[model samples]
Target chain A: MAFVEARDLTKHFVIRRGWFARPTVVRALTGVNLEIERRETLGVVGESGCGKSTLGRCLIRLIEPTSGQVLFDGEDVLALHGEELRSLRRRMQIVFQNPFSSLNPRMTVRDIVAEPLKAHTNMRGSELTARVIELLRQVGLNESHLYRYPREFSGGQAQRIAVARALALNPDFIVLDEPTSALDVSVQATVVNLLEELQAELGLTYLFISHDLSVVQHISNRIAVMYLGEIVEMGNAEEIFHSPMHPYTQALLSATPMVDPETRRERIILEGSVPNPANPPSGCHFHTRCPAAMAFCADEKPPLREINGRLVACHLHE
Target chain B: MTEPLLRIEDLYVRFRTDEGTIRAVNGVNLEIMPGEMFGLVGESGCGKSVTGLSILKLVPHPGRITRGKIWFRGENLLEKPESAMREIRGRHIAMIFQDPMSSLNPVFTVGHQITRVIRRHHHVSRREAWERAAGTLDDLGIPDPERVMRSYPYELSGGMQQRVMIAIALSCGAELLIADEPTTALDVTIQAQILELLNALRIRRGVSILMITHDLGVVAETCDRVAVLYAGRVVESGPTDAVLQAPAHPYTQGLLNALPRPSARRKSLQAIPGSVPGGIEEIPGCPFHPRCALADDLCRSKTPIMTPVDSSGAHLAACHLIGKSEG
Candidate 1:
């Protein structure tokens, strides 16, 4: 069995315009299915409103999924309750996209990192302080920064503090939702390197969710392409980058501006933006803007099936 | 050779905060030829945006262009009066920002905004202005330009809104377009569309574009020539192919090495040590010396001037260790 698995995960948000208006369902996650092996990074790549964030939240129960089964180490995560859920929370942590906003502005670095430890463990006073310092040190920060507030730090330093806090509980799995997106390229490299080092040392698994294809390809062992809340393609990172089966994935990879000027790919620009998730298309949600979309694409919802050693959800592959 | 379209010499911008005077753009120089896509690339607080804003004299309050010679078509913009500058804006030069939604007025319809700028710049009938507005939107590849003109900004998607912004910028038949992170908020596919649209506009209208962005990939793909901005300074300037392929400055090289490339999977990225210095905390000599791998005593004491990297003299970098070899 995979170390972590999500089956038929779905989420729908009901938003009302006004008091007299009827609530509309925004289908954030239609049905996402994937797996992550032990100490491996599963990259979830998609554009805005594709429900990548929602999927990350659902796996950790941060947002309640309408229907799904999340398995952690052969156990049903959705079935946990009370202290069981609390202990599971300790093992699973999350880092948000924006570090400055994620870290409490008023709280000092020590307290922010220690808050998780305090809630999950009974260690107090000097023992907690020592642990917090050790956590900061592990993230390349020193004890001198213990008393500094989040506002006193740069975006890179603030992100480090967030990582220190996430590591406070020694989580076995972390949902990194665009952790490096808000950072500069140079600083993003530091954080990415730190995450790789910590993963090697601690044997931690990462759900590295980002829109940056290059960064995703660099860090992830497996890559899953999402479009309109559906997993369109899943395979080894290298295979997905080199030979994308789905049309959306192909367009996304082509549209990505490569750093090397000599190897510019022929861009396949999609006609329109992502459709409104609240009222998605009839069948394949991506059919409206897909370059190779056919008539049946609007009537048939493709199923995720294994093809050529990878999973693809498209009639073209069939 | 023909004269340069826009030339900035010894430009300096400063913002006076309570902490100290933040030198935003310090001793920056640039030259944009006609019908060229010039990229000003940098990280946050590197003054790329400020430099663009300074070109149009649009620096927000508390920030002042303390010293600069903005020469546009052999005329110094600084010597122009406020009225002359206003006349030049929109009629000769136009700018678009990163967020089209915020840049656009929410209450007014798109047609109202575009026609207003049209009438402001040229002597035209209201009917003609509206017709031109629809024509510009049509030229930008917006489907059903009539409906888009009648709709408010909120009714449009991000990509559509950005296209509308471009229409407004180009409606006046401006010669130079200063786009500040125009496609940063867009998705990759949408960004590609916008970039293609910009390139098409350059070719169709023969308008010079000054693209300000932090993404080197964007610069590599679209820009003909590029300039690298550090903390308030231009550290490198060269043809895009030369600078990207064989960067002379350590800061430029560091930034390129720091990016996560697909070919270097699982390998450790060469992250530059330390973060960018804050605005108030000024560093002497080379601003990047603190983070540079090749910093030495000479680099710590004296700022290097821009030196030619090759025989053509088109490629340039400001670094003390440019020609030195490590012992």
Candidate 2:
């Protein structure tokens, strides 16, 4: 069995403007199906409001999906309750974006990292301190940082502290939702390398979500491109980067500004922006901005299918 | 040769706080030629944004320009009175920030905000300013400018809001646009569109742009010339192709090497150790020596001055080890 599996997961967020106004339903996820093998990193790439973060939060049950099943280690995760859910939570963890805001400013590093251990385990006093220090060391910090508040640290160091806290439970799986996006390039590298090293050391499966194509292509074994709430393409990182099958994927790859001036490709500037999730286009949500969109694309929803040894969802492939 | 459009010499910006004096920008020098897109690249706390704010005398409270000469078209901007500076601001040079939502007035309609700026700068009638505002928006590829003008800032998407912001900035026919991470808040496709629009504006309108951003990719794609800022100083400056392709400073090289290239998949990235200095802590030598791998006794004791990398002197780098390795 795969380490983590999300089957036909769908989420709908209802926003009520006022008592008189009719509530709007935001279809954040429209049937997302994914599986991550043990010790593998599955990257989820998309723009803002595309449900990439929603997908990550749904996988960890941080936010309940309106429909569908989440299976971790072949066990039905959504059905668990009370102590059962608590035990399940110990195995799966998440590190959020914006490290400083994620951490409690009032709590010291030791208390912050130890909160998980204290809740989940019976370790107390010196034992808890020792374990917290160990976790900090794993993320490249030392004991001297134990008493400092989150405000005392820089963005990179605060992110390291968050990583240390996430590691407190010794999770088998982690959902990293744009962990390095809020950081500078140099500090982002430090966090990325640390995550890779820890993954290897702990044999952890990751659902790495980000908007950065290069960072995702580098760290991910398999890459999934999301448009609106659907996975438009899924394949090996190198294969996807080299030869993307979906038009949206091609546009996204071309749109990404590369660091090397010589490798600048002719950009496919997609007209207009992404459609509103509350009232997306009829068939493929991307059809409105898709350059190669056909007549049938607007009326018929394309199914995700295997093509050229990769999963692609487009009428062009059909 | 024609005179440079804008030149900054020995710029120093300092912030007074309870902790101490934070030297945001220290002895930075740069030159932006006419109709050229210049990029100032740096990580956070390296003083890239402060340098941009310094150009317009818009540094926030508790912060002041300690020392600098901002010469625009051979005139010292620092010597201008408040009245003259106000006249110079929107009339000659305009600025757009990273977040359009915050920068724009939410209470006013897009048309009202744009026309206000237009009328403030030029002696035109209200109707004429409104027409010009709509025209500017239309030229920026915004669809149905009439309808968009009626809507408030909160009603528009991030991309549209940014385009509206650009419309307001360009409404007065400013020659130079100081864009500080203008596209950072938008999505990639929208960012590409905005970058294309900026490049087109530079080409067609002949407007010089000073783009301040942390993303090197953005610099590589849009900038004609680039300056790499480190600890409030320009560590390296050259043509975009040369500086990006063959970066001479260790800091610039470290930054480029830190990025995860598509070709170098799963390979360990070379992370520069230690965080950027707080800018309040005094360092006698090179500010980057603490993080730089090739730091030595000379780098620790003395700061390096900008030296030409080759015969042309167009490309320059400040590093003690620039020629030492080759020798």
- Off-target runs (Cα >4 Å) in candidate 1 are B325-327
Note the chain A TM-score of all models in turn.
0.98, 0.99
lDDT of 1 by residue, A195-285 (tens): 9999999999999999999999999999999998999999999999988899999999999999885446789989989999999998888
Best by DockQ: 2
Candidate 2 per-residue lDDT, tens place, B1-327, comes to 878899999999999999999999999999998899999999998999999988899999899998989999789998888899898887889999999999999899999999999988889999999999999999988999999999999999998998898888888888899999999999999999999999999998999999999999999999999999999999999999899899999899999999999768899999988889899988878888998888999999999999999777999999998778879
Native contacts retained by model 1, as a fraction? 0.85
Sorted into a CAPRI-style docking class, model 1 comes out as: high
Give the DockQ (C-alpha) for candidate 1: 0.86
lDDT of 1 by residue, B1-327 (tens): 988899999999999998899989989999999999999999999999999999889899999999989999889997888899998888899999999999999999999999999999899999999999999999999999999999999999999999999999999998999999999999999999999999999999999999999999999999999999999899999999999999999999999999988778999999988888776877888999998878898888899999888888999999987667542
State what share of the real interface contacts each candidate retains: 0.85, 0.91
Model 2 regions lying over 4 Å from their true place:
none
